[model samples]
Target chain A: MKKMLLLYVVVIGTLMAYLYMVYFREDNGGLSENAGLHGKTDERYVMVNFLTGIDYWKNSLKGFEDAAEALGVSVEYRGSTQYDVQEEVMVLEQVIARSPSGIAVSAINSEALNAAINKAVEAGIPVVMFDSDAPDSDAYSFLGTNNYNAGVTAAREMAELTGGQGEVGIISLPNQLNHQERTRGFSDTLAKEFPKLRLVGIEDGKGDQLVTEQKSLELMERYPGLTGIFVTEANGGVGAGNAVLQAEKIDKVHIISFDTDKGTLDMVKSGTISATLAQGTWNMGYWSLMHLFHLHNELAEPMPDWRSSDVPPLPTYVDTGITVVTESNVDQFYAK
Target chain B: MKKMLLLYVVVIGTLMAYLYMVYFREDNGGLSENAGLHGKTDERYVMVNFLTGIDYWKNSLKGFEDAAEALGVSVEYRGSTQYDVQEEVMVLEQVIARSPSGIAVSAINSEALNAAINKAVEAGIPVVMFDSDAPDSDAYSFLGTNNYNAGVTAAREMAELTGGQGEVGIISLPNQLNHQERTRGFSDTLAKEFPKLRLVGIEDGKGDQLVTEQKSLELMERYPGLTGIFVTEANGGVGAGNAVLQAEKIDKVHIISFDTDKGTLDMVKSGTISATLAQGTWNMGYWSLMHLFHLHNELAEPMPDWRSSDVPPLPTYVDTGITVVTESNVDQFYAK
Candidate 1:
């Protein structure tokens, strides 16, 4: 009888202990090491951008997915189907409505998505910006290439190509901060160092291929002696390449463009286009999620005496490095 | 007492059955549905290449790693530390001795490593060639850019750049079959399509940038009216670009270079190089491993009349494809 009583007590006590550990774990979240094994995650992160299918987003998205896999969490990709700022804003609003654990966004316009991004952070969701950034937003970090430094690199490369003396011009998007910064960097660098290279003018490509082509043609026409032209974006570079091809000025007027899109790479390979700068796209996606993960897990402590306990101690910006692609290593840039 | 004995027997048998199922599952490979759990991987695959640390191998290695992760298998990167063919042969022999599940190699020399590669096949290990191939060997498939077509593309692009009129020269490595094919393609294409564009000579660059530069200078000196030159490799292309730069014929001498290396890309960006050809390097590494995995798992079936049971019914050649990089989209080629 005593032995039977002991067996009953031992079994019941084991069951109670197991139940208590599970209950405590669920209540506290799996932040504790002694808590041991974890279950299928309740955490889901989302990446928001414009023109979701473009090759530009591929590397970044891969990084984000890799980070998600490493963390044993789920991730969803959301963006405007088209290249519209308003559409991206709507997408952000929709993503916020889902109330994901965290969000990483590449803003189409600097200020257009600020309200939506802020609202998510206000609702206790972590938001991180990548590629294109929104400066005024309450996001944890801006992870992307340094647009200004990219322009400076372009300027230096251009001087090398042009022998530090010639009439030069810029074909760029006028309103976008990234584009503007690139243009400013080029203009500033040229003015500061290669004083012999004169800036003819800056023409807005409007980030359209055909428009960039036409604008570039007009610039070449306006400045017949233009030795170099720096295109601030990928489409603009291709457009400029087309203009050079049409003009039969392949060897005369050097063209420096931005980004490593298929069209631009083709032009560079064919000799119609000059060189292009490639961004560290993968880093942006990987680190954005890492920042969000820390924020969501509350592993990153908030700044001392801060107004709220939400702020993550991540840096404001991450400068993903750039690579210069030319004829020699052009093959490496293609999808391997 | 008999009733108690029967109860004890039933309880012990039930516990033993449960424990038996768990133990049997833990012993077998995770191929069964009920044994759904996976631990630190027991499977290991490897990639072998030469000049292992060069930027050229980065995309291919990444693809191999990515495929390994997708298959829930572990992968190792191994290769000749230098660009030595004999070293590569030794590396292959060592890898074969380890008797890995499968192997993927980018052959440094066409026929030198055939014996080692064949030995691996004889040992019942699967082998696939990527980038530079050994066609006559026992390797299952070749995944790389079609060199002849790439040369033809360069020829056509050159014709367009030069307007089908001018004397052209080629700077290439004559010993390499890939380079030989490229040179032949360019010579044939130009001879057939553009009668006026004369091939003054094909000088061997010896796959050295400085040698290519010297040869390009000689070509220019030999034919002062030389309007276009085709370089059958990356180093040769950069050398040709430098020759043009020194000649100050940026407006007159058009250069068509092969491959996308940093120096060539820089020259192209600067308009010193007309264009470059980009290969699908990532596809080679990814597909090779994926193919090997299928072979290892017995997922790919053998051909009906094939001599060996080890063969996978994959294509003889993959033709990874190529892209043209130019100024317009040169930036896109950079690593983002």
Candidate 2:
């Protein structure tokens, strides 16, 4: 009886040991330890942006986060709560102060972010811009839509909508670099390529839905024969769509907008809006973080022109890609 | 004159000092110092999965990386290059050996990944599953689509498409956990909710375009009066659309697919596909990382029973959202 009891005790001890190692042991370098690395002071990547609340930023953030996970790193998202230049600048400054492994920013103001971004680069913190950009910043790269080309695409789409001969108006955010570029591209293309189409008015929507709607309504009133309207942002497009819908002028006015927020897509499906320019938002987020990770880890050398190289040898600004979303193809955009 | 020269030199020296401190100094933390933290670190973060090359994973990685960047940490993505169970197991073991910060896995096989996942959890590293999940694992959380519910939504959509009275077939990835759940939801609902809509056949597309196309063609041959086909993935939808186009059955057969890949969307636009279920892929990628970040940082406590507390309290399993896309709304999905 004594021997049996002793043997049972020994067996119990072995089982306990195995359980501890399997369930409670801290194997920091083991495969299990990888899951423990989160929020533990070792995160080395940061993604900066302007107005992080928008759906447009969501995919990009996912891309940034996905890359971070793959590389065994952590990331933080900091951005302006609103589309205020000063707020964006302040956020960038605070991010710079943290001295993270890397920084990816979306420039709200091209000139405002320049000094601070250069400071980050000089201090060895690699920076990459997305969505919008600062062309003169010392940042190593810019990962986002080729705004100008996208605008050109939008122009062609508008011309198509108007049958290449009609008066059209544009509602845009003039100060923002991407919007500015898109506007320029659209206008330039319309002028050079589509002689039959005349651009009547270019109004600033100020990136606000209500403002855009009001402005669009004003444009409609001002240009009685307006055949089409191009909106450079999601909110603007929806607002413009609403304007057309409310006016019951859907048959006469064709609206093209940017981005794919729920409201915008819904309008398109309902024929309130005609078409939209879809950017490679996923690519922007994915490549932006990838570039930041590489630069942060010194995995790649910085190109001579950081702003241009974000997309790398492709173009200073990567037209990650653009798709013309029409009712026929809208099913593809549905989330699966 | 000598005094003035000395004053000029002093002023110049002061300006240079300020510039160096502001612009050139390693103010944020030096990259070299952070680089050392990732080097030979005992803690690690591992992302495990099946078929890792898909675009959806890109955003998740970005989230993981963003967290790493902010926390000065590291992570690695390891998974099967193909949808193979054995390969996933092998990768999991390799990751386990390295001892990571935490593990975020998208289980290809609930049972196959069970032992390895349990091993990681038992080893004292927190494990979280994303995209697809292993419910039985000791994982702290599952961050991904509420696929079963998504399927129910798809059923409602199909009913709308076929006027609730026609036969439909399903194409799915047979072995995938999420797809299986989706199929189950869809099948159960069609039987109980829409009695008039009969499900005639189920085919395995293997999530390949060519295979899906071939299988859909065969289904068409077998069921000449098939009114609609539901594909649980993007490629299958595109493939099914192609088959329909080839068969010249566009008016008779309606195609509803999942996800928002360009190819699938194009078909939807062209009227080859009736509609698609767009998953909140961006949300999946974003929220997964947010959960991982919080879990790893110990910023938030893990829920006691993710399945139970999933909908309320913390929302463990989020129905990021799903939208029905058809030609009517295609314009809204377009980017401007």
Candidate 3:
């Protein structure tokens, strides 16, 4: 009898221990600690943009690569060599043919690339937009600066530089949606917030150095009291700075510009531009890849038929963010 | 000798299989399939706000609770019964004493709550701001509507409704930062884009229904040509709607309002208010918790000594997002 009792106790004891190990470990939210925050090495992602040769893409690409490294995945950077919508569409079509795990695109023209993006989505490939967006397309999310807010930031910074009182002008790419919003924001904030700061003239720079310089000169002549100027693009910033320098009005005029391109940063350093608004380009790249990974892996719970659904699994828009870069902090923006 | 060789081969084969399972499983992001997208049940997060009784906070709180549930965590909602800054500060202090996993706050005053927020951060707790923000505070991230952009969205909607023409007026809480930005956005966009849509007057609503109605009447009386009115808060929206309804000017005037609170939604549904701007309040709650979770779990790579560091581990600002709600879409916004 004693031997039989001992055998029963041992059997029950072992069973109890096994059950405890299987059912009672609650430290990891019901998941094994080793089961998260990584992906397969073969899972490939691609980023496509127009005007691929500009230094503007350096930070964004680095961010994409960094995210790929963190997630243990591979990434490729592809885009049209020229700034043509048709070329970009063709490149996207080719990328969709290979059907890399996912694609992040900066559309050259908002409406022109919808067909290609839609085709990729219909084929079960996930897509997200960055920088420039095709809003009507089926992209899961848009990661970029709120250009209007960027304009507001610039206006605030300009107020601080110009002591909230001055005649200001804008040199912008009027044809582009992003620049139009920026110009509106800068002009509006000035009208409402700084009663004394008058926006005198807005001239299109055509996004060219010489044209921007000419526009800056013309604006200065039209409003000689124009003590402040805001350039909505990097090349225009340098152009406006040159105009101010040649006119010997560097001290008399203050300028705020956009982006952290090397030329723009150099102007900021030399006080040709008082400050520039730097978009969260790196965040755009990194978060775009992250969003793509989540969707591709089905880790982010998508709404039922999310493309046609009222809501999406991911945030529809992620404001990558913006910061004001002035002489004090401009050095950190320089590429190492 | 053949039998001995067979035994050696079997043993070596078993060892190789074990090694492969441990080192080469690449299906996951180098993690176990069951790991990630979850957290511990015992971990608690708290959401703090100023007006605890208002309907404005319902969606945001729901979002916070939803995120907590998804993460296998618990959440507590706490706030001041009144709008007093001191009361909010004290409530936050109380929340800090308990040392929950993280805290999300919607600050009442832009500058008054900085010390309390910094206190929470100093105590080695993760903090994020949602909805309203104290920009100078040491919170890890701010997830809120970019009020300026919210204004811009409203302005565009107004243009669409008014056929980009006619006189419009604003009724708003001018003292509040959010409303000021909205008013500025509406007025600025009107002045720039809709040259024929003149912003004839701006009246302080004091966030009161009767007061707003009186102001609306005053505005309409003063500017007989006024064909549109934008109210920057829910109460004022309904009030403005009532004024138009009573004056029998519903057909002549279009109203654009802010928020999707029940009152606002009902008005939109009834066609009393032509449209309202629906802020990404839910996104604010969800992303705030996500940010705090990453910070608490050390999943987000923070700058060394991020408290004093110029850089943070996470994105500093996130524009939760915004959308337009008219009669056709107002039903979708009603809380189930």
**Candidate closest to the true structure, highest TM-score:** 3
Residues A1-336 of candidate 2: C-alpha lDDT, one tens digit per residue: 556556556655655665465344234233333322222247578878777787777767776676566455778888998979899888889988988988888887778899989998788788877777787887755666667778998999888888998899999988766788899999999999999899999999988899999998998999899999999987888899888888889999999999888888888889899998776666566566656665554333222443333222111233345668888766555433
- Sorted into a CAPRI-style docking class, model 2 comes out as incorrect
Q: What is the TM-score of each candidate against the true structure?
A: 0.49, 0.44, 0.73
Q: Which 10-residue window of candidate 3 chain B scores lowest in summed lDDT?
A: B26-35
Write one digit per residue (lDDT tens) for candidate 3, span B237-275: 888989999999998889998887788888899999999
Which parts of model 2 have CA positions greater than 4 angstroms off? A1-43, A302-317, A331-336, B1-336
Measured with C-alpha atoms, the lDDT of residue A246 in candidate 2 is: 85
First chain TM-score for all predictions? 0.84, 0.79, 0.89
Chain B vs. true chain B: TM-score for each candidate?
Answer: 0.85, 0.74, 0.89
Candidate 1 clashes: the total is 50
By summed lDDT, the worst window of 10 consecutive residues in model 2 chain B runs over: B306-315
Q: How accurate is chain B of model 2, given as a TM-score from 0 to 1?
A: 0.74
In terms of lDDT, which candidate is strongest?
3
Error of 2 at B50 (Å): 37
